[model samples]
Target chain A: MLRGFLVLVLFFLLGEALQKVFLIPVSGGVLGMMLMTLTLMFKGGISDDLASASQGLISVLVLLIMPGVVGVFFTADQFAGQWLAVAAALLGGTFLSVLSTLWLMSRVVRLGGGKGE
Target chain B: MARVNDWYSRLLSLPETLSASPALAIGLTFGAFFAGNAVFRRIGRPLWLPPVVLSAVLLAAVVALLGMDYKAYQQGAHWLTVLLGPATVALGIPLYQQMHHIRALWRPILVTLPIAATLAAVYALVIAWSLGATPEVLASLAPKSVTAPIAIGITQQLGGSVPLMMGGLLITGVVATLFVDLAARWLAISDDRILGFALGLNGHAVGTARAFEISPTAGAFASLGMGLTGVFTALILPLVFHL
Candidate 1:
């Protein structure tokens, strides 16, 4: 598990360095993810240690992100004048997003002659 | 005699020293999270009260009660936050595992990802624009559906406030988690792959977490959706704005 963490951190750091040198728009973690995916594809399998370490981290993803969510409370001024706009956009955008994807996928599945269910 | 006195004084100041240390913040977070988890389990884990949300709300309340600034709390919590980088990279495992599913539906996924992602961003921007949001706010909202790290990067690339982007991401996630299920039931679309993909695309990591609760297939698809959406949007949005 420790070795797995070492691999993940090394990939992440490399991704971060790449982003810095190349001005990549994506986050280091994301670039690292892509890089790791490619590497795993090349290697053709995940090691048990890496799998366990990664799963351990993934399992508590919420805890890792919670501090940021809590950080939102302190930034009240940023949304002071436009809470309604933010609220509407979030609600409408999310609902529409889900609906559109669902609608599109089901329509495509039906056309492709697959049982979508 | 002097050494004993020194030890006694140190013991007396232990509470203050502990509070000043990083462990306090870390302990507070995990303590709140486990407590929230306990409460969630006790209450039967309703869709509306995810442990993360409950924990965040509770943690915020506790911080406010202690008159602690978010920065001070974050000083210690940053240790955990740094793990997000590795954790996100680790997501590759699940995404790679789902390669066959992705390969099978490559056509539809390829077709749907860009369109769904574009629609998600545009709808939020248009609605917020119609509702009188400032340009910066709109910029921040543009990446609301993407994962937080990538969303932060995209928001920065677009000249948006990190705080607003984070806020939008969190709320969008919570809203998506609650409503997507309702939308699925309403649309009568029961394919975990499709449903999970939507959840990941619109909800980002929070949605992805919820998707895992549904099933491993859903989890895998959701990870795929999130990674692809992140890559696509990260590559495209900045260029669009640059133009």
Candidate 2:
């Protein structure tokens, strides 16, 4: 447990360092993840204990959305009053995004046409 | 008693007959989500599956009908809010398991992460600004593509309204999900890692969920993307928005 906490702390610190030294646009923790991931790679793979601990934390990552869910409680009124604007924007955005992804997927398949799908 | 009424009021605060419990308020909020998620899944609606959204809608409706303030509802909702850190810390596990796979692609991650992060951050900012959004809102909207908890914190740090930031981020996540693959397809984007990671990094949980729907490998990339993007935004947003 202590190790996991320490590892997390390390990521936090390293994330700060990477930004200062490397000029990366992404965060230190992310850099930390990249760092951790790299270390795991260097080791050839994670130790079973490290893997287990990491996995345990990842399991319920979804529940973290709860706090965010609460955030919407405040935005509800703005949504109600100008739903058309929200709807129009979200709808337009969703349409453009999905269409673009599907198009890419199909093209990829066509290009890989030589390979059996 | 007046302080309670004035400062941190509960939704079910009855004046005549008093039942002073925050649980009831939280139950009402969660019950809406639980029920909405159930109904949406059963009926098989597109928007229903992500109960986070549906729950938000239902909670709003209940509050409207009850004449409750967002703050009042928050008395209970705050409990759920506090759990975000635990949830964030928890993401380390799946990431740990995927370490071997991620390790094999370190060079690509190092090279591509910066490029993708720059593009996503700039793109959102340009769009929001071009649309005539104010500076503070632009900062909030800029990080919308990443996951919620981190995005929320980033926006708040940068001086955006937390709730507005949350709404913007949620909408961005959903919008990014619907289009990332299609956008990549349009650009002739072929590498799943490039396509998946870019979207996951930019779109956050919604993007990751969509990636998971496509493939486990893609999902792994998506997770990496979320982890990477959140980390980047944590560092970068403060710099960009703080100024």
Candidate 3:
């Protein structure tokens, strides 16, 4: 498990180095995830070490992100005036996007001869 | 009454010792999270009762009530923030496990992922812009569909406010996760893959977590959608919204 975590951290560091070198706009962690996915694909399977380590991290994924969410308290006052606009945009936009994506993906799947089940 | 007042005074003075301790910060965070999780589970895990949401509210309330500055809390809680990158990288495991499915349906996923991502961003920008949101807010709202880390990076690159972007991301995740079931039933969408993809594309990490509760296959597809959407948004947003 520790080895697997070290490997993940290595990948994340590599991603950060690559991002700095190439000036990629994406976050290094995301780039690292993409890189790890490719590595696993080519390797033909997930190692138990990696699998267990990742599972441990993924289980508490929400906990990891909570710090940033809590940071919102620092800037809550900024949105006080635009809360209505922000709320409308977030709620309205998210609803429409989910609805449309579902509709489009299903249509495309049906067209491709899959049951889309 | 006098003893109660002394206890209250002692409680107020506790921050003097506890405020600077990382252990206290971490302990408080975990305690709040577990408490929130207990409440959420006890309440049967309603859509609006996400553990992170509850925990955030709880933590914020505690900080405010204790009269502790946000920065002081952040200083001690910084360790959790450091793990965000690794947690994101760990997402690759699920994506890897689902590789065969992804390859089999690459045609549809490849075709639709970009379109779905673009539609999400465009809808957000248009709605916020028309509603008279300021430019900074517009930039932040534009990336609300992507996961929080990537969204924050995109927002920074576009010169938007990070805090506003975080708020937008949380709201987007909660709303999408909450309404996705109803939207699917209304649209007659029984395909778990499509539903999962839609959820991840719109809701990001939170939605993907919700998708996992439904099925592994759904969870896998949702992770793929989320990863691809993040990559696409990161690549495209800077080009379209050049500073």
Which has the greatest DockQ? Answer: 3
lDDT tens string, model 1, B134-226? Answer: 888888899998988788788887898887788788888888888889988898888888888888988899899999999887888898888
Which 10 consecutive residues of model 1 chain B have the lowest summed lDDT? B12-21
Candidate 2 Cα RMSD (Å): 6.6
lDDT of 1 at B61: 91
lDDT for each residue of candidate 1 in A1-117, tens digit (9 for 90 to 100)? 999999999999999999999987789999999999999899999999999999999998888888878887888875788999989999998888888988887777667734333
Docking class of 3: medium
TM-scores, all candidates, are 0.91, 0.68, 0.94
Score chain A of each prediction against the true chain A by TM-score and list the results.
0.88, 0.69, 0.91
The interface RMSD value for candidate 2 stands at 5.5
Q: Candidate 2 docking: what grade?
A: acceptable
Interface RMSD of each: 1.8, 5.5, 1.5
Taking the tens digit of each residue's C-alpha lDDT, what string does model 2 give over B1-243? 897776455435442122144665666766776776676687776732465566667767776666656566666566655544443444544566555566666655665566556556665565555555666666556666667766765776677767766776667676676567456656666656555665677668767766766766677778887887787767776776545
TM-score of chain B of each: 0.89, 0.81, 0.92
